[model samples]
Target: MKRLRLPIPFSIKTNMILAFLGVSLISILILNLFTIHYFSEAVKKDFFTISGEAQSRLNYHLDDYFKQIASSTSTLLKSDLNQSWLSGKRVHTSDDIDNIQMELKRYVAFNFPEIIGMFLVNREQRIISMTGNINTDSLSYRNEPWYDLPPNDSLVILPTHRTAYPYPQQNGTPVLSLLIPIYSTDDLNVTGKLVIDITFSKIHDILGKSALGKTGFFFILADDRIVYHPNQDWLGMGVGRTDLASLSFDREEQSSIQYWNGDKMLVSVKRSTITDWNIVSIVPFDEMSSGLKAARGSTFFAFMIVSVAIIAVVPLVSNIFVKPIIRLKQVMQSVARGDFSVRAVDDAGQMEFQQLGHSFNRMVEQINELLETVYELRIQEMHVRLRQKEALIQALQNQINPHLLYNSLDIIKSIAYLENVPRVEKMAKNLADVYRYTAKYAESEVTIGDELTHLSKYLEIIRVRFPHYFESHIYVNEKFHDCLIEKLTLQPLVENAVKYGIEPKGGHGAIMVSAFQDDAVLVIEIADNGPGISEERMRELNERLAFITNHVKDKQLPQESLGIASVQARLVLKYGEDYGVALHSFPGRGTVVSIRIPYRSPKIG
Candidate 1:
């Protein structure tokens, strides 16, 4: 059977089209990134400002509500204490209070549609009369929270509670009970508490009708306890009794201007001018920033349209700009792969492309003059890149040793878990942090603050691992606390000091690690009291220093020795000759490894 081979076609137009598309896509991506970043930041700032403004306006509205209540209550007090009313008090009938209740009811219904119900509880301890469908027979003056309030110098609005008022619908509807003590004319003795029932429906009627958008609730609270909530069952309750408080009122929410509860929610509360009463309003977070949301949506859509337009136009623009260049690249590639037989076609009559056509013709004439030298140089460059790639791989391996150390810490945590120890969680958390820092080598540089955080985690894990064999001490200078170092640099050095320098000592050992900045450089030393290095081995390492630029290229030592060399090599490669490994050891006393590098500030950019 004969095998048929398909034709391998090459086209200059196709290559040019593809390159133009790629460049256009990359340009669009970069523009979108920058535009989207600025757009999102602007949206967030506007949202925050709008939320703050809405909350302030809400607080002002609440103040206005309470002020109206105070004025209306004061009117009732002035009228009820009239000399004619006192003289006619001998009648002492509900009719006498009824006259007062009727007039006040007219004032409230006309001015405050939100006023749910109104009443006058006379000095006789009987509810004199009420307006808006009052069931006087069912009302309990003695047991009600409103009736019990002391007739003090100022009026008070009680927290929310279920009230039986306003006739046929007098079920467990929420209401705020406003109480003002009625006093006699001649003698300024304490009189009966004149109570007014301002229903939740009234608040709903006023705020709900006028609210431009968003669902909101206006209620009162007595400290942490609910006075009157729209959710009637949750009213007159304390914090732990309801899920609303748990979800909505965490420690952080107390101080935050705008808070997130699944969605944004803005809150504002004000203390009443007349009493200890507080009026609070809650509005949907989005409603507070609806204007900003509209702006953001418009901006986002505009950006998207612009992005699509840019994406669509760029390739067309680039095709026009780089048509000649694309043809040049195609001819060059063909020549690069030993297709010297291929030649440019000067089909375009345009002057620039014609010039390019002549240049291509000249290139074909002198191929033999430069081909061999170019090939040799290319091969040499490839060899150098291969060596560099190998070195990079080695460095990566050495840098990742802390990953194994993290696994060991995890094992220790599992043991702690099995033993039902409370400290296990703490140990596990620290172990996780250590691995987090070690794994974040992609960032390459981390702060002294972060290094200390990682070291603290490592030591915590080590403590859990050994339990009895080792105790560690960390000392950091105040001035160098914010310096930056190569990520994961400290953990390996400390690990080596513990494993090699301390463990070999027959009994218990101490590992002391200190970090300080001096002479514009960071000096970190990990010293331990255990088996110190021999003079001969130290001299041998000192001799090989110049040759060993990284931990991976060095000859294999024991696990502990490898950790120290790995840390030193990374420091040198990253920070240059000024930064590297130093060893101090006295045979019986112990060993110490010190690392020095110029103190770079913590990365903020």
Candidate 2:
């Protein structure tokens, strides 16, 4: 391994002390920094987890509460006595009414303190009240507030609304209803509707008890509206101003940290399948700040103690470990300044130092020997040149086989690819045409029209490969067709566009190949609407292209980027450093790979 030659800023002893101090302090600082960072992130994750659990718990409880109401609605609909009365199958009787009220009171109303009552409305507008005396003498059942019901055949939970009758509701609280169609026992025909009303106060109470983090609260949300909030006044209000509703959250990312009204909040939500409502939790970020502050303070205190100890021990450490190294350096410096005769003689009585001194002295002796063998090296140089010439001849003889092998492989690959898809003869013909264009090595450059023809052949195969999913359009004017460009330049860039934009995603997208002249430079661009390269990937690609363009002999190409890399490299090498390819891209948006080269006037006839 080669040692980095950092310039000396002070005496060797003083540098050792400083280096030890810097390394020790930096290590401690890094450790503490990692500790603080882990602590802060762990705190954040912990809070979100707590909030998520709270939201999930709220969903469970709300589902259970709504399920209970649904169960009762089913029971009432299936009841023999009530069905007969509501369906008008039996004559009116006082005993039947008493039995119906008793059953509802015994089995349903007593269990849920929040339920005000449930009413049965038959086809004839007859009403059966569970709460007790209903003043239905002059009231039309359809005109009542609780009459806002869903489809008679479908079970639906309605949002909370105010009403007068269903009088003496639990403390003037507003009511939400669960509607289940009353089907008769015999024919499974719709008889009437069962409306089960419950108070919003109970939902608020339930939300209050299942608290989340220090400053977090759980509530019920439905389509961006608050069904029930812990604060009773905010019930049935739109929560549009809150971050919980404002951000277009990814389905995969359930928790988000965002700000609303100048306060940062952690919001998490879980949807209740039973109620079809979102159970949301929002916690102020201030709760975690104090805990993080305390943690950072503790880490800083520990770091300070470690730093003080390092300040004291660094000089003592330098004295013991750096003396022998300083002595060896003095000898090496003399050699570096052209005094090759100097050598390390003293070893400080240490075995490691003794071995090091021996190696240094041997290196000096080898340097002296190298100076004396210049005459012999000249004879070897002639032999080396003769071998290089023979190797070049052998290399030229071997180059043709690879081109032949590549041509054979291309035919086999095209046959294999065509056998799996619908288009066989057409794709085979196009693939052959593409390979034919690539086979010629006599002319390194070709006219723009010929390059587009090659690109068209490749794109047709791609269009066939991903039928109805991939498309291509060439918008370059015919005037620029005769402009000269490096062969195979446009095809590789188009392939890159297809690879990035459509192939990985298996989605419908397009590749647009366009060209225009900008003064002396001709710019050809391959643009794709497929998911694009990220910033880091784009930067790395441009850097690789630039590196290959600048250094032509460096053929160590990465497998994934062989096409675009070769295109940029060939362009820059054929022209000059002023010509190469560049990528402009945004992740999940698209990418445009542009090739810029000097415009040579239309090829002479």
Per-residue lDDT of 1-605 in model 1, one digit per residue for the tens? Answer: 99999764745445555556566666656766666556545544554444435444544565577667767665556664333353345544556556666777776767766666666554544455445323245244445666655566566667777665434566566677777666655576555556676666645444444342457665656777776566767776785677555334332212223454576555545544444545555666565455556665665676567667656766676677567777777888988887877777676576777777777877886775578779898999899766774565455545464454666667777888888876876777686666656666666677777888778878877777778777888888766666777767787778777777766664378888887667877788888898788999889767655445544333442333346555655666667766777888888788888889887775532
Worst 10 residues of 2 by lDDT: 393-402
Q: What is the lDDT of residue 62 in candidate 2?
A: 75
Candidate 2 Cα errors over 4 Å, as ranges: 1-37, 40-57, 73-75, 78-81, 88-109, 123-154, 164-172, 201-209, 241-253, 260-265, 284-295, 306-605
Worst 10 residues of 1 by lDDT: 248-257
TM-scores, all candidates, are 0.36, 0.41
Error of 2 at 359 (Å): 27
Q: Who wins the TM-score comparison?
A: 2
Q: Please provide, for model 2 over 479-578, each residue's C-alpha lDDT reduced to its tens digit, 9 standing for 90 to 100.
A: 8888888666787678777777888879589888899889988898888887888878877877877777666533333333337766665666567788
Which ranges of candidate 1 are over 4 A from the true structure?
1-143, 146-150, 163-173, 182-192, 201-204, 214-605
Cα RMSD of all models vs. native, in order, equals 30.4, 29.3
Residue pairs with colliding backbones in model 2 are: 501-530
